[model samples]
Target: MASRSKLNQICQFCRCTPRTELKKCHKCGSVSYCSHACQREDLTNHQRACRVAREGVIIPPLDFLKTRKEKERLTEILTHCVPRLLTALYNDLARWMEAKSSALLERCINDLKLRYTPSACETHVLRVVVSRDEMWPSSTSTPGELFTVTKFQVMDVQYARESMVLWKDCMRELEIQRREAKANGLGMIAVVGIECPALATVRLLQFTGVGRYLLVTPAESGQRSHRRARR
Candidate 1:
């Protein structure tokens, strides 16, 4: 049993059990890494949890939104797209953070402001919708009419301070649904990437354990949560 458990065990960052000893984080004691390199590699994802745990802050797990079947469907759709989605987010951030020209900075800020509109939850999320062209037209299709239900996966883009209200409002709405979030064809899954643009810093938020639940659609409200993607 001991050997079997070890075989199944993996590092929190690299997800591989190296030949070297695995070390549990001294502060949080919840994460284990196979090496210093692995720990450093995971710092972007683990920083918030480590600090919260060390400071004794208790964060409630965001409520689950979908039934097992629906969740499985959401997972199936997202499984293939997460990498590209994350890369897009990183690229978007890099373009902003590394901008040296006023024109470029202004353009990035305006674009991001539109993307992160506080009133539109969908705007805050980086989305991947199934291509309508790839979708076969139904009998009722008009020349330019769009489909009512779109298949998509969205990841939240978070900033600091004032955005906390937006995060809470999103949570309250989802919580009222009692965990039965709606599902369209593919349903939604939560992925979050945090940035403090003022500070020019970004952390790749990786949801682990129950921390995965946050903003979702109404048939979808519930799952991966929104928080201060702080500096």
Candidate 2:
């Protein structure tokens, strides 16, 4: 194994880090970044290498091709392809499962970070919500289209057993989601909650005498180019 000193002196892209906490690219284990900004700058190129040299290949399911809309396509890729790919790379993920609509889950998390600027306090429950627009493909879309929109309300916290193996299983899964670091470390199972589709903007909703939620409005662009930015 590379020593701590060795890790500190190497930079995967610029290769100028004489001594720093090597910011390892969570994907391909071979590359390390010197800083968060450095990693962000190298991400485009890193993904190419990661895809080619990473531990496993992810060929999307055949049904994915049949999905017409980009959102549906993305949904298929995240829900079907990603999990399968992670399972291939980490044997532990093969036995773990979390029921969620991929797009909504991602949208909610993005909305929280990009729009709401989440507080450091973890004691309060954060709600996620997404609404469908008239333009969005839905079950009522002309009778012959793929509309897979499901709403979810994921809690910021959820129940999970405590163990390195179990924590690892969750960590690997989150890493595959590209939201890996959110778990901070395998010290605890961090990403479990009420999975749901949320609004794009940060807003509050009153349900009864007193209740509110953070909504991620401005539905998905489906371009894949504007993926959630790193914090």
Top candidate by TM-score: 1
TM-score of each: 0.23, 0.22
* Full-model lDDT for every candidate: 0.43, 0.41
lDDT tens digits by residue: candidate 1, 37-89: 88889987787688678886543322364577875665555555655654544
Error of 1 at 19 (Å): 3.0
For model 2, residues 42-79, the per-residue Cα lDDT tens digits are 78666656865685664343444554686577867776
Each model's backbone clash number: 11, 18
Q: Which stretch of 10 consecutive residues in model 2 shows the poorest summed lDDT?
A: 203-212
Judging by lDDT against the true structure, name the best candidate. 1
Off by over 4 Å in 1: 1-4, 58-231
